[model samples]
Target chain A: MKAKIHIMLKNGVLDPQGKAVGHALASLGFDGVNEVRQGKYIEIDLAETDRAKAGGVVDRMCKTLLANTVIENYVIEFE
Target chain B: MKAKIHIMLKNGVLDPQGKAVGHALASLGFDGVNEVRQGKYIEIDLAETDRAKAGGVVDRMCKTLLANTVIENYVIEFE
Candidate 1:
């Protein structure tokens, strides 16, 4: 199964990198852009046959290493 | 309007960062992870009211700043 993961900062967390991106966009003449939050998208291809097992593995991956629990949240999509 | 951008390296490109991530996962006992590709997810909020206009702006952003057109491909999701 292939799992796609989206990891992003929590709602209340400060994202300086996102702010920088916004500034860059503005400098490039993209006016009126706001609240630009940057995150990560990871595509993992696994050999597991069982969908349940794949979901469990991806959940563990998110909790353990993929997303920083303190500041980021992750969503896993099984395909 | 809000647009979600997913920027990723083109298939022919080598992703050392993703390889390193896979290695780290294996070290952490995620043994079944095989081909892992990493990318960037950016959530952009814009003042443009028209969806078409938002798409155009995001396309330009990807071309000029958000993504390296030569080695990366970007998908824009309008919301």
Candidate 2:
């Protein structure tokens, strides 16, 4: 199975890197670009059989290593 | 309108950060985890009336700020 994990900073977190990129875009003459929020996409290949097991594994992945839960939120999609 | 931009290193690019996270997951006893590749997600709100204009703006954003084209690939979704 293949799972796609998306992790992003919570709405209120301060994202300095994202801000820098937004400033760079505006400087490059791109208009109507209101804001930029940066996040993470992680793809994992798992050999688990049951969907529940897979989700549990991914949840654990998020809680343990895939994300810093203090500042980010994550979602997983499996196929 | 909101667009989600996903950017990832092309296959074959050495992703040390991804590797480090994968190693950490394994060390934490998460099984069936074969590999991991990390990427980026950016959400934007555009006020353009034309979809093409929005796409053009997003393409420019990717080229100029959201992605480093030398080793990465990007896709944009419009809503």
On lDDT, the leading prediction is 1
Clashes of each: 0, 0
lDDT tens digits, residue span A1-79, model 2: 8889999899899988778877887788877777777788999888886888899889988998788999999999998
Give me the runs in candidate 2 sitting further than 4 Å from their true place.
Answer: none
Candidate 2 lDDT, tens digit per residue, B36-69?
8888888887767689878887898788777899
Would you estimate the TM-scores of all the predictions?
0.97, 0.93
Candidate 2 C-alpha error for residue A20, in Å = 1.2
CAPRI-wise, candidate 1 is: high
* Full-model lDDT, candidate 1: 0.92
Question: What is the TM-score of model 2 when looking only at chain B?
Answer: 0.93
Report how closely model 1 matches the true complex, as a DockQ value.
0.90
DockQ per candidate, 2 decimals: 0.90, 0.82
